[model samples]
Target chain A: MKWYQKHRETIVQTACLLFIVLFAYAGLTKLLEGHLFYDSIRNSPILGGKAMASLASWALPLSELAVALLLIWKKTRLIGLYGAAVLMLLFTGYTLAIVFFAPYRPCSCGGVISLLSWEQHLVLNAILLLLALMAIWSSLKNKGIPWKKTPQGR
Target chain B: MKNLKLILAMLAFIFAIGLSFAFMGDTGSGAWINYNGVPTELELDPCQGNGNDCKVVFEDDPNQTEYTVYTDDTLSQTRKSNNPEPYIIP
Candidate 1:
């Protein structure tokens, strides 16, 4: 077996750690600056309107935090990976839509992520989505338990 | 070993939250209008010279007759100026 195959469990653990940090940071930043996040949502061309903005302002950040929590425990890590992958997929799709279809683009993304340009946001989201998919595949291959199998057990 | 992993993950999560809090910008500083009775979508300024930090106008306000421009310098006497002139949208 290759070094990576031998260390698959470790790699999955590390990826899960990365995602927990990313989601927790992103969520907390949005929650901390709730007013700014609300303003951003209100200003979005695609996501305008008081009702939509209000719903997203709370939902997006809370969802991220929830995903982080889910990833913290081994029993729920598989579900968390799915959530992260879905969220990233949605974000990536939104970015693409803004780039091609929107009359005017306004980024409602939170924190340091808002500083990135549309192209950079796409690249970053794509990378994150790929990582999330890989994590899910690894977890499934291990039957959702990312532990090494003993020779006798195998 | 499991406890160690959990502790490390918790520490990393806390550290990330701390860093994000430290870098968070001024909240409620940007200008925004409630899109309650807007008829048409307003244009967003291309944000010339300003790096991603700016405000946006969503729609025309039927009740608002004057637009207030807030300057950054509080010491400057013209901190809040009311411009009654109507905006010409080209």
Candidate 2:
């Protein structure tokens, strides 16, 4: 079997697993630090007005959780991957926008995500987004192909 | 494709989640509304009577006047100012 054929399944599975864990952690952080997250949203420049900011604070985490849950199931993994890509893009774009244009930066994103500098955060998000795309594309191509069995399971 | 609807629904569900999150915090933690209704914290003591510490605006009252508040200066005359307003502590 060709190298691409041999490793395609492994790559897709890893991507799915990565997204599942990433979204779950992201969601749990928001749930655990709900108050801090809300304050952060209220301080956000993107979600103008109190109402939208307030909603985003909690919505972010739950959305992450929803994405993770969807990715976990074989039947819904594609949908989950698509959602993950959208969320990642939105997050990355927000980070880039605030860093470059906003008068004041809001540190609402708590946990390890917050620890990264804006530039670093953007890069990390971009990487994840790319991974989601690769996973989705590979899965789509592998739809009708028989699984290539390797003697040593990766 | 039917799967397309599912993807769209997933995104829509998040917006609903955002609404729920917005309503979750009854009293916004670590923040208070300022004159503009922006979420901010009082970094300085409001009761200290430092004229620079706070700006109190009674929008509904007729005074419609702006003042640099100075009061509670009993201990230190250097920071105290006598204002005609009776309610303002000196």
Calculate the i-RMS of every candidate, to one decimal place: 7.1, 12.9
Largest DockQ belongs to which candidate?
Answer: 1
Cα lDDT tens digits for candidate 1, A1-154:
5887777778888988999989899888878877667766665556566787789879999999999989888889889999999989988997887677766555444566767888788889899999999888888777754455556653
In order, the Cα lDDT scores of the candidates are 0.67, 0.59
The best candidate by TM-score is: 1
Q: Per-residue alpha-carbon lDDT of model 2 for A1-154, expressed as tens digits?
A: 5998899877877787667666776686678666556545554556544677568867888899889888766788878888998998898888778778765444434544645777788789889889887787888777863346447767
User: How well is each residue in B1-90 modelled by candidate 1, as lDDT tens digits?
Assistant: 759878877887888888798877644433322234332223322122222233233235454433322233231221221112222111
Query: How good is the docking of model 1, as DockQ?
Result: 0.30
Q: What would you estimate as the lDDT of candidate 2?
A: 0.59
